[model samples]
Target chain A: MTAWDVIGFLLVLATAAGIIIFSSKQVRGKYPALFRKIPAITRLKRAVGLSVEDGSRVHVTLGKADLTEAANTSTLVGLSALHSIGQLSANSDQPPICTSGDGGFALLSKDVLRAVAMETNTREYYDPDLGYLSGATPFSYALGALDALEESGAKTNVLIGNFGVEAGWLTGNAEKHAQFTLAASDSLVAQAVFMATSQDFVIGEELYAVPAYLAYRPAHIASLRVQDILRFLVGGALLIGALLKSLGLL
Target chain B: MKILNIIIAVAAGLIVLLGYFFRIPAIDDLRGQLLNWAVTLSGVAGLIAILNLIFGVHWKRVKEKHERRGASLVIIISFAVTLVAGIFLGPSSPGFQKLVTHVQVPIESSLMALLAISLVVASLKILQRHRSWMGFVFFLCVVLFLILNSGVLAFTSEIPVLRDFLSAFHHAPVAGARGILLGIALGSLAAGIRVMIGSDRPYNG
Candidate 1:
């Protein structure tokens, strides 16, 4: 490999190490206090409560992106959100049903739901099939999810993850049924943006803050802090690099 | 059996990677054969999925005639027309190519264009709703990129300062975007590594 290639590879490795280290530390140490103060976390409980009181099923979608996809943070956030929703649902008469687009996510979602149910002492509510794997195709998954939501009479839909243009179709369908929707995705796709605007609440990178808010995972919180620090550093570097380059300086 | 299937999946994935990056004659031939087999399997899978959709929709229509009947009819008509045409004329035939060009392309393109328009409208709504600094920055970047990409400002080269500024901004944003993208890529890489190592075994069940 060339010298430039070696440097680039090392830089990438260092960044990955930094994120993992920061996230892991935050997960272990300073997450609880951070979780307590997040307004979005509080709103989630209120949403879940409204669903339970109205005797409506809580609809959760983990998106079509798999854990190995670039949007792994979305998967983590979705699972964390599910954990909170599952716990809340356990206390209420209405149970939560999760629909996933990826097989691996479906499997993880089931475990997350089951764990929450067990934690809430509502193990009986835990069903293996509670986490349904819809079609892997974007439109097919959206169609299946919409069908399930309509059939189940879901009152509140919380969708988080990476989605494509077809997400608007699901959001529009959900809205037509008068279901309160809170959706978030990191996708820059216009369709995803459209769905988010139509929903009651839409979170962006804020989706990554869920684990920090819910479990008080120190690593997750620290990771966010680190991400902010990195963002500032990168922004400064960009400005300086542009200035230097314009001046014919390396 | 599941373990063996997983092992085979891993091996096949590795082979595909090798086939893509390496330049060996025997490996290339092996890769070609494997690709053909994979495509055949994918075609079969697609066929099965379509069949399932047809059956599922028809069954729902049969069971609930009032609501699903229209959807079922549309599915049936689309399937029958496409299938019959393909079977008779074959994919490369002039008749099949004409249908593809005249009917399929226009319909698909129009639908895609509609979706794209909706997406743009939705993106504007997101900007209006969020109104955060980051959101504003993202929205601004997108608008600027779109204007430049759409060739609307191609005639503006008559203004020297404006031209230089636009060129500089374009080149400058690339570096910033590259940096941000790198951070995102690193974060994603970590997460993927965690999953592969089974540390993030949320799907282990």
Candidate 2:
């Protein structure tokens, strides 16, 4: 391979390693301030409380991406959110309903919820079908979620993780129906686009900080700090690369 | 049984991956056949889904006095038109093609355009909501990209350097965007792998 190819490959490895290390640390609880700064992270508790008081259900959507997918960040965020929601809802009369596009994710969502219920001592409230595996196609899943929103009569829709253009349709429908929507995902562009139109609260890269906020794990916070540093490094690299290229330098 | 399911799923996933990457004739042939079968099955599933939608809508309209009867009517009419066109003129016939060109294409394109416009407007709303520096930056980028994409600025060819710079800026973001997109694709692929292995079963419910 050429030198540039090697450097590019290394860059990717560094980014991936950075993500993993940061994620692991965040999982262990390292950064509290970052999580606190994110309004959605704080609103989660309030959302759960409101859901309980109003006798309304919480809708948690695991975007179409499954756990094995490279964008494991979304799944990680989704799982952490599920853990929080499950724990909060355990003592209430209602349990949060988790929805997924893929069957594999559906199954994992079930396990995650079950685990959360066990941890919170609300195993009796655990519903295996809490994680509904809708259709794999984007539009199909949107339709399924629409149906779910209507049927469950959920009050707060907490959408976190990977989503696509169809998220617009789901969020639009939710807004029309007056359902409170909170959305977050790592794909900033798509989520930002959707959040722009819908009444959804969007959490961007903040999704990576979710585990830290909910679990108060030092590793999770440290990882987030590392990720922020990496983001700054990447931004710097891009700027320098652009300037060098403009100056006719290699 | 669980082990059997895992083995079958892994084998299927491997076949799919191989089909995507390999150019061997046998593998290509198998992949083609598998794709055909998948298409056929998807068609069947589509039919089932359509039936369910019809039933659900009708039931809702009847039992719950749903206010969206117009939507149901539109669905019925569109389906009928497509079915009639397909039955009488066949897929490639002039009548069917006309139906596609006139009815389908326009509707689909217009809807897509509407979606794009809505995305732009919604993004603006989001910027207003967050009122953060990052949000403003994102909003600015999206607006600039959309304006350039619309080709309205191309009419200003009278200013050569300005036009050139705008064009370059328009094209420049795409390279970085593509890289980010590739990373997302890889991430999605890994997540798919985890799901296939049953390590993440969020949908068992």
Q: Looking at candidate 1, what is the lDDT of residue B57?
A: 40
Model 1 whole-model lDDT (C-alpha atoms): 0.64
Model 1 lDDT per residue over A83-119, tens place: 7677767767667888767665666677787777767
**TM-score for each predicted model, relative to the true structure:** 0.65, 0.63
Across A1-250, the per-residue lDDT of candidate 2 in tens digits comes to 4576566556444544544555453544553344446676567667777888888888888777644455655765687678767777776867888776655556566778877777678777776666665555665576667767776788878777778776776776676653467777667565655657554464445555565666654344544555566556666887899999999995
Regions of model 1 farther than 4 Å from truth = A1-42, A66-73, A190-192, A199-204, A236-240, B1-154, B165-183, B186-190, B193-200
Clash counts for all predictions: 12, 47
Candidate 2, TM-score vs. the true structure? 0.63
Q: Write model 2 residue lDDT over B40-138, tens digit each, in one string.
A: 654554454444444544444545666766655666677678878798889999878987789756755665576677665666577666577866776
**Worst 10-residue lDDT window, candidate 1 chain B:** B196-205
Taken over the whole model, the C-alpha lDDT of each candidate is 0.64, 0.64
